[model samples]
Target: MSKSTLKKGILQLLIANVLNMIFSIGTNFLLPKYLSVESYSQIKTYQLYITYVAVLHFGYNDGMYLKFGGRSINEVYNEEIQKNISTLKLFQFIMTICSVCVAFGLHDTALLMAAIAILPQNMIAYFKNFYQAIGEFKKYSRIMNMTTGLTFAINLFLIAVIRTDRYQVYLVGYIILSVILWFVLEYSLQRIKEFKPFAFDFSLRELYENVASGILLLLGNFSSQLLTGMNRWFVKGLMDTLAFAQYSFAVSMENFLNVAVTPISVTMYNYFCNHDENKDIIRIRELVIAFATVIVATAFPVKFILEIFLQKYLDSVTVIFLLFAAQIFYIIIKSIYVNLYKARKMQKKYFTKLCIIVIVGFAFNVICYAIYHVKESFALGSLLSAIVWFFLCLIDFKELRYSPRHYVYIFIETIVFLACGILLESIMGGILYITITIILSMLLLPDAMKKIWNTGKVMIIRMRKSKSR
Candidate 1:
């Protein structure tokens, strides 16, 4: 793809991600304050369970994206797409039913209801990914932003007008909106004829093949989730619901900061998958380094902003910082893996290393919590897991003739930037000082500034061209 096209793609991705961040931030800020700490924790837990459901449906969803998405709709026809969709829908339905039954059997009525309510949401997400893979950014962006806005508006109305103490009301509203959006999306796709439903001989052969690989992928993903989320679970166990509520807020802030990197990662994978030229590799590497630099530069100011806005919840700032660091590490590792997976269909080498890191992370978290406590153990586990994943990613990249020096440089820059921010925060005792330090640090990063300029110029050109067209 041309640079202009890539720039446009990134811009759309950025808009979608920004809308997502806004929706998430609005929810996090409003919901917890409206609901009691116990209710907030329950809401968060159910959300996590929903995430686990998504993971369980990973095979079909990923299969759809990889097989049907990478090609034109005509190239991969309605019969194939519909078959995969039906199979996936069936699989997801079965999983959902089984999960609901199990929850009921365990007498966990709250979780069962939450799972049932979130099923439509998950279905909408699958369709969203399909649209995304097909490059229908306009439709996808509209659905995402609108659904998010609707969710936020409903939550606010419930809290403000109805005075509903139950978070389930908000969840029900979310599910209803999701179902409406899904139907709209499906209708829109049908207008194109290519997306029309058609009967095909449904077979599990292809699905089984994909699932075999997906099983390993699923395990890897589950392990990563455990490593990332175990802390929150542990916090809930060790601390009170209020403490978990506080940590969740901080996590939401960190997630908002990292949202900017989402487009870079998505575009990186698509760019690498479609192009194999030597020149393209150079460009990819530059993009990766530039993206990483910008992310590192932006983290400090974003954190500063969060601390200011969430002054009432500043106690979790340190924990949030650690989580932010871990998230950045995750972005780097995932970016490289996206490229690796695209180039080579499937590899067990990185999978093995990921398994090892997960094992080490689990042990580290368990032992540290047993020895020290919740807060310190969580931080220490995140730091250690980052170190382990970093090295493992380095080893994997070397096998692909990729050097780790760029990542090393980015890591060092991040460390220095963070260290300077911490030092300034200690002495200055004001958010303004921290903000200035962050801005200065950003200015000091020449490569990051250049990338920003380049991206801006390309975007401006694209806008002018679109207007002329």
Candidate 2:
């Protein structure tokens, strides 16, 4: 795809994510008001399981992503593309079977909803990743935006029309919405030239081969999730439901902010898959600047918005700020090294780095919790983990032409900047920290600022066009 097309796709996806967050904010506010703390905790916990299960399945989608996205294609008509789709269908069947077992065996309505939701969720991810693999991002963006819009509409109906606060009801609604979304994805795939109906032929050999190939990437993905979700699991295990309710609420708010990062990271992966040094430098610069600028720009607003809507959980705002500080490193890692590792098929390196991050994160978490004994420990542990991973991934910097001087600058900048916001621990403090970050970043990295300005300008134009439509 042309760079222009890539930028457009990223903008569209970013808009979709923002809209999804809007709907989520609705649920975030309404749910806490109506559902008891225990109920909210249960909802968050079960949904967390759904996320974990989806990652655990080790589906062939990641394998397909590598094969199609990383490999140079003479044309999209390669026979292996068909095989990849067939294997994915078989993988979906297995996930479906797991869902059936969970629904029947658990006898818990919330868990059943989460269990069944996995199939459609996987299907949605598979479809999106397929579009991503082919760099047909415009179509991908449209499909995802439709899915999110539809889900949002459903959520509004459930909240305003049905007026139900029951967790089971929401889960069932999610299941139905997920199924409908799968159909939408299927229809969109059918329009693509490379698309084919899944053959009734199920290959045990291919399924094993594809899944086995993706095992490390899957582990890396799972470990990444574990590092983020580890704190929640700890909170759940160590504290009561009410305590977890507070902690999970902050996590959810941080996740809401994370919507801003997804499209950029996905686009970065697609861009990195191109084996061109010039393009790689351009892509990396763009990715880094965009994330650094946007993260700082959104920091204070995130806290303000959450406090206005989720007053009951206002105490979690400080936790959100620390998590946002952690997000700076997290975004940098994913946008650069993680995508680099995947495009290069460096899954071993990727998995190793992830394991180290999680292990160190756990150690930090233990010490922080034992010493401080507060909700902030979880965010602190996560921050410490990302810091270590950033340094560990430095070995690969030679490939990117990054020097020791660059490393030192980034290290000191991050520490000082995050320390300012995290230590100040207020909305004004967050705003001031962001201001300092922006000024220092521009002075230290003028080229990166230029990249950010270029990206920001394009986003402004496209955003206007979107509204005009």
Candidate 3:
């Protein structure tokens, strides 16, 4: 795709995700407000398992991502695509059955329901990743918008119209939606005229090759995700359902902020994979960080709102504050560094970095819980892990020739945000943060800020010209 087309695609995704984020914020706030804490916790649990469903593919999708990135879907043979999907379907079928049996053995209805949802959800993920890999971001964004929109609609109907308090009802709605969404994706794929029905004439050799090629990436991605979610796992396992509910609620809040950043991370992967000359790499990185810093300012207001609406889970208040600030660090690693690593085919380094942080995150949680035994420890651990990963990424990012002063600025800015959130009241902290951040950014990183300002103006002009045309 041309640069112009790519920018338009990215812009489309940004707009879609902004809508998704608004709907998601509604769903997030409404669910907790309407449901009992225990019920909300169960919903979060199901969502947690949904994230792990990617592992069920065992790198099949990741391999496709690595292999087909920067290429069009039509470039691959029809038979090859069909065979890959068929093999994946068969493999996932067996895995689902085995998992269902275990769930039955455990006699957990929620586990059983989650196990059943895995197959359809994983299938949907494959198609989603297919579009992402092929740079068909419009298609990808459509899927995202549909999924989020449907989710919000479902949640609204259940909570507002039906007035249902049963988590099972919600779970059933979600599972049915997953199946429907999977079929929708399949239908869209067929309509593309390049895709055909899978024959199920599978190839063990192809499966093995894909798994081999992508296992490191899969491992790295999974580990990175695990590191990100490790604290939740720790809390869910060790604490009461009420505690898990509170912590996961904070995570849900964090997801609201995170959705806005999704467009850049998604678009950057495609861009970096296709383009080698990254002369503006540092500028892009700085711009992303600046965006993230501004994004962090939203946390204070969210926390303030949550204080009024979700009074029962006031335990999550501080956790929300910390996670939101931590996300600045997380965004830097995710949007800039991780994409850079993947685009450069630095799987080994990527895997190593993830492993290191996972270990540190695990230790941080263990030691903190051992010492303080508070839920906030988990959030602190996540922040600590993110900080560690941020620095580690900088260490390896030698090609950018990024100045040490910039590194210090990032460090200081993050600390200032956290300290503001922790030290002052919500409104006061927010005002102070915005003022300090604006001043520091203007004073210390004037050049980068000016570049970002000019780039934004150009992007706006180009978008307006295209629209007029």
Candidate 4:
């Protein structure tokens, strides 16, 4: 890639993430204040249900990026790719009908309300993946930012206009916004005249072959979700809705923090897929270290911000700490796993490991719940599950060269930060001590600061040289 393209890609990523963060933070602030705890819990439960349904929408869209994205534009716009798109659309339609039927049959009002909005949501997601697969990062970033901002705007308007406490109204607004966004996306796709819609040309035999591979890939992705979100369901079953609500708040906050690294992760997958050689080893190492440092720095301050903003849910502090700690390991594994997926078509092996993670996670949840009460036990379950998944990923992708020493260092740093900050908060106060500690710790990272300064110097030198020429 040219330097201009690289810089533009980075800028697009920054803009997308910033917009997403704004919408997420806005929702976190507004939703809890507007909805009752039980109502918010209901919304969260429905979100979890829709998330599972989304997993079943096939994994070809994800596999498309790794498998086809590195190729030329003509190759990506091939007849086979078009056939896959048509088949995926048909499958999604069938799944939508099935999901609605199941939701209605079970009389799950919350899930049914969520299901009403899921079809359009999945359609937009598929189109976004298509954009990424073709390396149209600018377009993808624009659509994402616009959609996020629009969602927040719609929700805010509904809150003000409807002035109703009924959560179903919120669901209705969600469905309306999703439908409108889908049409806008469809129009946008049509405007790209090169992206012609092809007739369904693939036979069932061809699709079945690909579907088997897709299912394994889908299961691998689903297993990651299970490791991440299984705690919510376990906590809900073992404890009360209020506890689940608190846990959801903490998880949401952590996830919002992850918005910073998401662009890096997505770009890293594309980068490693295209360039897999020892020649890039030094560059990859620097990227990994930079990425890890960014995540750590962003996460530490955000935890304190969460405490300040959502003071009513202070009880979730322990759960939030554990979840954030788990995220460090999870992010490291994800960084390596992307490269592994790119290097080898080991979908079956990946799926097997995921299955193990799900089973182990379930067992941990059961054993913990049996031992202690729900809230505390669920937190332990999440921590243990993360540890197990990280090790399993390490063993499976042994070529990645991630070491126990690296993990040990990360764990020690995180513990020191948390322990000192917590102790000071207890002795002094929460807000003032946390703010001071965050500022001090951030300044201690000289290496990260040095990288930033050197990059700035290079950019300035380049600008001056261009002007002289």
Candidate 5:
């Protein structure tokens, strides 16, 4: 991708996510506060289960993503691609049927709903992966905006108009919306002028090839998801719905922080697909880390918001801070190490690293929870595992190397940040944390910080000029 195209794509995604964040403030925050703890817990349970629904595709979409990355969507829409999609659809349908049956047999509503959602969600995943792979981020942004807008509207109506406290309503609405979104995405793809039309040309050979090529990537991606959500899963299984709700609330807050970071990740993957310069990648990594550092300052205001708006979930505040601090490391692991591995086609190593992290993470959670028998330990364990994951990622950068200074910088940043958030426990502490972080950032990441300052100044000038015109 050209530099202009890259900037445009990133800008488009950022604008869309800004809208998403605005809408999500209601759906993610207000809705939970309005609903009863038990009701919200059920909704969170469904959300957790549904996230794993992507695995049903068995990597067909991932294979297409890997094969088509750095290319245009129009360039890759051939009979072979059609055959692969057809075969994958058929496979997904079979899996969905079997999974739904199992869920019904077990008499679990959440599992059944998640199983029913698999087909539509995986189908949408195919389109999303297509857009990301081909650098068609405008379409991706539209889909994101549409999903969040519809969701926020529906949630607001429920909270204000219906005043419904039943989790069933929210759960059913979510599945129905998924189906509708899938149809909309399909219609949009068909209207693309560059494409002829999709056709069902199922081929066993094509199915095998796509699955074989993408399965490792799919596993790696799934494992990464598992690593992130493992704590929530453990809480759900080990505790009551109320506890699960509180923990999920914390997780949700941490997820909202990703609104800004996700666009950078998506755009970076596209950039990496086209560029292999080590210096550029490292510089991007540092800037991204610096941005993550600065963003943590929002946690102070977030704490106050939760305290005033969702007072019932006040117990989750510390967990929220810990997760927020841990997120700094996770962002680097995700936007840097994982993207480079995929772009470089180091699928085997990527899969292996993720699997190791997942296993070690699981073991840590088990040990920590066993000893402390509290939710905080699980959150702490997640932080520790994330630190290990970050360290592991540094060992093999292929062409890039990090000095001892890099390690010390990240280590000190994480420890001091976490300490400030956890130990101080006041808004004033947050100010102190930000002050300390700024000093550390200037000392440790001066180059990245300088670039960010320059970029901010340029943006301000552009904004002023546009307004004057």
Candidate 6:
């Protein structure tokens, strides 16, 4: 793809993500406002159960992603796309059936909601990847934005107008929305340049091949979820529904902020994979560093404001601080690889990182809960894993170089924020530490900022020229 095309795609996706985050946060606040913590926690519970459906995906989709990640619209043919979709539909069908059985066996409304959502959710996810791969960002953004808007609107209608506190309402709304989105997504897919409708082609051989390629990716994803998603179950055991609600609330905020950064990761995966040499990856890192710097610096104030407005969720304040802090290191680790292993077909190294994260992350979280018996400890445990992943990126991807001092600086900065968070233990303390760190980091990141600005300047010039044409 041309630079302008890539830039446009990134911009569209970013806007969709930002708006989606807002809409999600709105429901998060609305739910807790009208309902009891217990009812709201049910929504959180429903969300967690839905994640299990993702676990069922088992990386079949990711294999498609790793395969098509860097290619442009014309590079791939319709037949191949049809085959990937066939594999996706099969896996999703199997998972949905399993979810249905589990939901009925347990006789739980939340599980049932999950079962209903699995297929539609999986389809929505497929289209998101599909549009991105085919360079259809306009459709990509439109469909996702529509879903985000409808979801929030329907949710508001349910809670505020209907005056109901049943978390089941949101689940029902999502199932309906997901169904609509699947049709909309399919329509959008049909509009792809020179796209043609095809039958449901089946290939047992191809399906097995797709699974073989992506199972490790699946394991990595499933294990990662165990660390983050399983925390709700673990936290509930440690405390009550309200406590889990608070932890879940914090995570909602953390994940919301996380949405905005995703376009960077998404685009970077393709950008690096499209190139053989490390030079391009290094250029991209400058932009990554700049973005991370801004996200880390602003995280505290944003969390503080959300905490103020959503005072009932006050328990989440500390959790937000800790999780967002960890995301700084997470971004660093993410930027380092750019999904190079998957792109390079280095499944061993890719699987290795996934294994280490799953093992170390699970061990730390469980051990932390055993000691402190609180969600705070769980948050700390995740940060510890991020620290480990940072180093793993350095060692595993030996294709690049940066200053050793750069590595040490990352460690010290991470430790300092973590120490401040643990020691002072107040919103004000976090803001203060963030202030100090921002000042210190400014001293270190001027070169990165300069590179980012230069890149942005070129992008803007190209975009303007394209517009003039």
1-469: candidate 6 lDDT, tens digit per residue: 5556557667878877888777867866776667888888888888888776766677666666666776777777877777777667766878788878988999999889889788878777777776655556666667667876787898889877998877777788878988888877666666763344334666777677767777787666666676566556778776888889999887876776556776666665665555556776666665565466457644455456565766777767667767877787777666457366666777677667767777888788889988987778888888788778777777866667766646655656666665665455357756776676566556666666566568789989999999999
Q: lDDT of all the models against the reference? A: 0.64, 0.71, 0.84, 0.66, 0.83, 0.71
Colliding pairs, model 5: none
Check candidate 3 and list the clashing pairs: none
Q: How many backbone clashes does candidate 4 have?
A: 0
Better of 2 and 4 by TM-score: 2
The TM-score between candidate 2 and the true structure equals 0.87
Between candidates 2 and 6, the one scoring higher on TM-score is 6
TM-scores for candidates 1 onward, in order: 0.84, 0.87, 0.94, 0.85, 0.95, 0.88
Q: Which stretches of candidate 4 lie over 4 Å from their true place?
A: 1-8, 72-74, 78-82, 193-206, 278-286, 293-309, 403-405, 420-453, 459-469
How far is 55's C-alpha from truth in model 4 (Å)? 2.7
lDDT of 2 by residue, 194-297 (tens): 55655555666767776778888888988999998999888888877877888887787677655677777778777777654755564565447446545644
Best by TM-score: 5
**Per-model C-alpha RMSD:** 3.9, 3.6, 2.1, 4.0, 1.8, 3.3
How much does candidate 6 score in TM-score? 0.88
Instruction: Tell how far residue 160 is off in model 6, in angstroms.
Output: 1.5
Clash count (model 3, backbone only)? 0
Return whichever of 1 and 4 wins on TM-score.
Answer: 4
Q: How many backbone clashes does candidate 1 have?
A: 0
Error of 3 at 447 (Å): 3.1
- Write model 5 residue lDDT over 1-469, tens digit each, in one string: 8767877888888988999888877788876768888888888888999889988888888988887889886687656555666677778889999999999999988889899989888988888888988899988878887888898888888889999998888888888998999877776776763333345667888777778999999999999899999999899889888788889988888888778887878887889988878888888888888877777667777777766766888888888888888888888888888899999899999899989999999999999998998898889888889988988887778466776666777777777777776677558768887888788879888999899899889899999999999
Candidate 4 yields a Cα-based lDDT of 0.66
Give model 5's TM-score versus the native structure.
0.95
